[model samples]
Target: MNAKTTKTAENVTRCLKCRRVLRNASPDGYGPKCRKKVRAAARAEVVAQYKPHQVAKAQELLEQGGLIPLRANRVFLAVSSDGSATYKTHRAACTCPAGIKGLHPCKHRIAAHILLAA
Candidate 1:
């Protein structure tokens, strides 16, 4: 019932899930495959926490150029199709209704992520 251990100059660790010796010192002691599974689980957890409409709205915003960055990435303004400004942000959401309401990531966040990726 005891996990295997590996010793190196840096540290000694064992895989918490599989009880295998870990070559590197991961906080969770997960091997490569287990780390992938952990990441996937975390992603799934985040996806499950969002409402369906939020995801759809983010996708629509990305596709329709609804997000406009003003002043050299210092701020973003997200305009809806109806021509109403729904969100604004510099480093974080400033005046988004969804953000204000504490809902999941609004379109502004998604747009900012896309812009940063570019």
Candidate 2:
């Protein structure tokens, strides 16, 4: 027979709005529903902080990766199957058809930008 370690229900989990319990919690000890809301809020905060700077830096270095600039501020890099292009301030779009369909910039762009930043 296994002996129960003697722990109260409050020590493990807390009641959620819909009665579904959560196994994890916020660092300060939030109940399941509250923990979920807190996690979402934290993720949003992180995205807001890093997205803009990351896009701008990536755009500025597009040329170093053998890309051609389509505009004053845009840069394009070629891939084996397609091409990639981005703007100095926004990397969300590129000239490659794959870009039109929504794909990530490639290693060359990344390396060029990294060198430029250095």
Best by TM-score: 1
Stretch of 10 with least lDDT, candidate 1:
38-47
- In Å, residue 36's CA in model 1 sits off its true spot by 26
lDDT of 1 by residue, 61-110 (tens): 64455655566655767776577555675435647776677556666665
Clashing pairs in 1: none
Please count the clashing residue pairs in each candidate, in the order shown.
0, 3
Best by lDDT: 1
lDDT tens readout by residue for model 2, 1-118:
3358765557554322222455764333345454355345334433343345554543333322333323432343344323343333224444444444555553334422332222
| Candidate 2: pairs in clash | 67-76, 67-77, 68-76
